[model samples]
Target: MMWREKEQVLMFTFTFVIYAVCTIILFNIMYRTQPTPYMDEIFHIPQTQSYCKGNFTKWDPKITTPPGLYLSTVGVLVPLAQWLGWEVCEVYFLRLTNVFFVFGNFYLLYCLLLNLHPQISESKLLLSCLNLSIFPLTYFFVFLYYTDVGNLFFFLLMYTFHLQGQDLVAALFGVMAVFFRQTSIIWVFFVSMAAESSVYITMKRTKLEKKSSSLQFLKKFISTTAALPVHHKKQFVNVLIDILDTCGGYLLTAVGFIVFLYRNKGFALGDKDAHVLCFNVSQVCYFLGFVLVFCSPFLLSPGKVKKFISFCIKEWVLTAAVTAVMILVLEYLVQIHPYLLADNRHLTFYVWQRFLGRNSLLSCAFIPVYIFSGWTVLQTLQHKDSVWQLLYILCLVLSVVPQKLLEFRYFIIPYVLFRLNIQVNSYIQLFLEFSIYVFVNAFTLVLFLNKPFYWEGQSEIQRIMW
Candidate 1:
């Protein structure tokens, strides 16, 4: 174990050297061509500058999320920048904060996989961690002033701590994550329940022992107890106590969120009008399809495709059920928020115009794609306990189902969470994933840098981004 841990360090260092070289190259491009705040960086950079300058009272109304990003920037990186003789308030320097966040995220993801998949080889874990770090949706913002990477840092930190059985520390970071984005509160409770489920599912295998999750696990354990006669009613009590212990801190975090809701009257601190809640179940389909495409390199390989086909044929009923449900979701629940229609500078706008939203038939044609994507993604998690799988589906629904907009950044955490848990067949699969990320990211950055266009009535040139 010690030698493998050392090997992991070596792997992390090797991966870091590659990622760091790429980040520096991207940073130079941004510095030379797009040094000023672009897009949402306009809001994020200025607000963080305010916090850095010790103006705590100033806030950006256009910023819907809380001040966690600003607080973290000012609290840690800002001072570090000063000590390093860097300009703490420059847009370029502020963007540098997330550059460092990239490093931190890489290490945190390494620790997370360490705790979650100790049986895996050091090299495989490194690839999974590095692949997620460079995932196109999240990686594009690494050289920009964005909260997505920073918030994800906290999210990964929270889950890593939870996996290590440091539940209270995990819960604290969960609150910090909520402070970064209101939607992150969903994952906060998700980590809580997932941790609880881990304890219950792994309980036998300690005794081996939620509403949906808790109640379902209880029913199974009760039935299994009746048959096995090892974990009795008394042992069940012990399992329940352990579950409560695991989830208690996150429950407090939820209470704090409730109190904020009661006092503030809603989830968003500002710009509630734009961030209004909606039941756009279509977003979930789009996300699943996005995940499928990214994972297609491995998942669409000949052997995997054959397996998928076999499963579909043998379990035709299940395949039909998934297809039918997707049909309903696409037909009635598809939504197109105004931003998607208006923002030509975003990749989603073109995606909507060209593929999914070009016509009703074109959109509905994606139902099969959604089903295949969803099935293959679920197949990756097949080795997990039934409760873990169930809770994962439930959490993805809660996280993805309510978005009123069609932003791919919202897909980042869910994709990372899903990708990290899946099995990899070979080094070739990991290489394929890395190859895809390189192609997409290289194309994206080249487009953004060389293909600048001016928006009507706006002075600064605009570049498309994910």
Candidate 2:
């Protein structure tokens, strides 16, 4: 057993090392020229400089993200650069901090995959590791001097803990990730329910397996139905007990009941459960925190029943929900605490416009990337017959809508979640795997080419005969 554990660790470490090296090389190629980092990067450097100069007051507002990365930036890199007689203004060193975090992100992803798919064989594990290395958009964000790098790491870390049945740890990590980028908080809503649902599925399967040998149990229900006598033979009480044996199973059973019945569409037993009151309470807490931003008021106010009806019946309910939340949050913040908008702004369309307009070529390139990405996630969720897939779809819609309303940066975390969703078939699996490799390498090559990376001669290409 000890030897087996060591072997697993060795494999994980080996995979991590290879992936990290390849990622760093790709990033080095991409950011070689211009080297102009984002404004947020510049903002952080000044904060760190203030801290190093024994001035901590101005640093407080900039500490929206956790102190872990900031401390390292100030204590290690800033000091080293100063000692080497180098100017602190060099953006390369600040970007270098993200280089290291990218590996840490990979490690977290590996650990999360392991936790979620522990039953997978060694060969599949290696394949999954390679999958991480070749993930298409990972290169773009992983090497940037942006909070997304750190947020992605902690996001996966919390997800890993959730997969391991550590909900509290997952919640904490998720909260931290959202603090770095508040829009990511919506993911916490979906993931928590999904994790709970997954847990329930596992437990139900286990109980069914444990009871498989019992034949007499079917005799009682034989009179009620023919083909599924065994299914009908069981009482709701007995099934409920089996579900109650584990928290996850109970939620799943409830979700099944709520989702399957047309009258209860979008409702799950888990949603109705008193125990889930705690989760709702957590949402309320998040709403309150962002209250100055507008979300809290809408949730608190018993808005007109017509709006709720519209939200429910809308074809794009997920999109509508996100927009409504954005309006609610933004309006409240503007009204009550306009001062917050003076310095640290919240939920503006400015970010989205900048991403698409400023990064037009790369944004266009990302279209195929996201298409393949959405295709993969949809295929995966469609593989299962359970109502949970509907919830997953809603979540996907919610993820995309924010990018439409606010900024393209909002799409980053959602896109990551979509990609991380498993593939339902070999076709999707192979396509994603191949696309990640080809796109990353191609993007790198494009950046390295002497000419501009923009399209030059699409109409001039000749088709080769098969």
Candidate 3:
């Protein structure tokens, strides 16, 4: 009956309600369209059916997805069909494996949250919703009947192992993830190597016994440069500008050095010169990686720097960028293109119908989502959570593929969860984010349903589900 006790009870109820609402919404979306067989479902069902029927070659040998998924898929399908006196290709039964795997991933994510934050707060609830509401993850994998669900399961398990200090087990899982889809491993691995090196550098440096403030660093740098002899002042400024420009090419663009210096002033790590150095190094690595991923095309050239940038662009670069632009542009153009004098409709139809297609667009949108998912990878790196850092980095490295890559579901799951955890500090910011999320997801859901069915009537299995 005490006021404090009442407050505690109220908080508990509020958190529980938000969590329940998110969970229900996720499951409802996942299951409502369950009966619709996506194009990939045709491939998955046939492979699973063949495996259950003991026709090993029924699955594609060229399909080098992880062996664990194959074994588990078979295990789930074979025994259940016989016990229930249903065919392996049975529609409801066929999608069971995917549904189970999807839910299993959610449970794994919950466990991860529990481990990372033993005592949950409202932020935890918000983070949980942000993570679980990942439109791309569920949108791409759950309905498509792809190996992403299983791949994601293993990827999360890998993180769990690392968090639990089981490095060897995590490495094994990391390897399996690569086998599922090579690109997933590549993303995680790059982060791991980069973070490990950072920690090592941090360990070697002496810790600061007394830290100075950011204002102090700025004051000292400004006063020192200002007081320098007239000749040295310009030289010092030029040197500073050169350092920034040579480093990331970011200094030459937009607000450049001023903006960077201002941002780094806060991230300056007080008076610990060593910590400051290490932090700068880590920031450079992350910023470079980010720039390389997002804005590489702007910097492309034949030189060593540009070559490296081009290499980082990867084959999916065009697909990913174009897809994001197309989504934002398509609605506007769909009505006007047909009326254009040049028969722009023909051009649009050719591009959408024959070339890019719906499935390809899904894959393309999935790439940006997966890349954004790496926002968590950056946060984990900053926190220097060694276990997570290691697993995530390794996964990033091993999962990379050069072209037409679509099956990195494992990395996608952690990427989303990690991103959600990297929220800014404010109620207003959170509300704005939630509003944008609602609008985008609503639009995406509509887009997903309205697209022509690609798998229907493809085969007997397709009829039941697609």
Candidate 4:
């Protein structure tokens, strides 16, 4: 048994090393092809360079993100650069730093997958790792000086510690995640739920040994209530109570988030106009559409789709209530920054303005899509039926729905988590997924490398707007 375990470890190591080498080569190719600063790097690179110069107090006014990334660079590369007396190519060094984190992110993801599904085959594990490394939006960030990769790393670390039952360590990593990217504060609830789920599962399993009557009663009650007519007041109340019991942590987290925003003087930072929340139903559709596209591989199975639809039908009231609440929250209550809408160079902006006519009809048209997204999320929760998984899905939905800006990169962690939770059983399915993944990344990379655009009258820049 030990030998078999050793063999598995050796195989995983060999596969990871190969993927890492290929990723490094790909990064180098992209770097050589387009070495200039692009997108947010316009601010990220310059700020990091300032850090290299020992101007710790200096910050780029245009960079809204916290100084974690810059401070990290200063802590690591500044010393190395000083030791080597090399002051040039600071941007490249920063990108290199991201490259290191990129590798770390991949490894941590692999560890996470293993912890989540210990019975997974080596071949399947390798495929999962490859899928993450080549995930279109995430792959693009590897060659840039962005905090996205680091955010993913810390987020995965939090999950890793959670899986190991190290709740405090996981919370610490969750704090790191939030510091790196303020949006990551959602993980506080996610981590809390995960720990709570672990306890719940353990207690339930222990109770199973004694055939606890409460467990039996709860199960029978749920099954009975699920079968009752929707118009039944008792049934409705029971279902509502069940949902609240399951989701109470999320409600508490929401309150904490409000407190956080109050303390921070509002959720928007740096460019306040660029990140506010507002009633933007189209943004929710856009993000959900992205989720569908990203997860099309898993959704392709007829059985899975049928299962998801059945789950929605089974819990129609819960599903409808959640979906309605989501839409209402997004439309009337949320604040929107509309960063993508502000940038005219991207496809999303034109889609909203020109194709969609910026009308309510467009929002109404995507109602089914929104319902489908909600169903998919609920299906994920039901499959796991764990407090942590439910909380994670809630947090993910909350994070994206309120944003007026739509970016594929924002969905990275959720995408990874979703993919991990899904089971891909067929080689044909795997091949199709790999094909789509490669095609998407290749197309995006080529478009990013060759497309010409101007930002603020700076001519001939090759950058992806989102």
The candidate that wins on lDDT is 1
Q: List clash counts for every candidate, in order.
A: 9, 8, 27, 7
Tell me the tens digit of each residue's lDDT in model 3 across 1-466.
4985577557645654664565446545654655655444545566666677788755453344434455677777777767988676555555556666665665567667667655555454444544453434453445445667667777677667656755456656665554454344443343333322222222222121112443453354446545544646655555454434322221122233246347646322122231221111111122223333322222222453453345447646754565455454332222211222222212233334443345545424433333332432353345434434444454443332222212223235444544434433445544554565455455545554444233445542211111
RMSD of each: 4.0, 16.1, 17.6, 7.5
- In candidate 2, position 221 carries an lDDT of 27
lDDT of every predicted structure (CA atoms): 0.80, 0.48, 0.45, 0.68
TM-score of each: 0.89, 0.52, 0.49, 0.78
lDDT of 4 at 307: 75
Worst 10 residues of 2 by lDDT: 274-283
- The residue-by-residue lDDT of candidate 2 on 228-345, one tens digit each, is 2256445444444543543443244334434444552322222133111111111121222222121111122234334444544664666455445544433332121222223222
Report how far residue 45 has shifted in candidate 1, in Å. Answer: 1.6
The sequence of per-residue lDDT tens digits that candidate 4 reaches over residues 19-116 is 77887887888788778876677888887787777787876666766777877777888678768988744667788877788788778878888887
TM-score of 4: 0.78
Per-residue lDDT of candidate 1, residues 1-466 (tens digit): 8996687678789889988997888887877788788888788888888888789998888888888878887888666877997766787777877888888899998887777787878788888888888988878888888889888999999998888778889999999988888788888877776654434543543454333454577677556656533645665566556656677788889899999999878767888888777888888889888988898765676776787789889999988887777777787788778899998999999999999889878888887778777777777787776566766788788887787889888887888888778777688888999999989999898899889888789787889888
Candidate 2, residue 383: lDDT: 40
RMSD of 4: 7.5
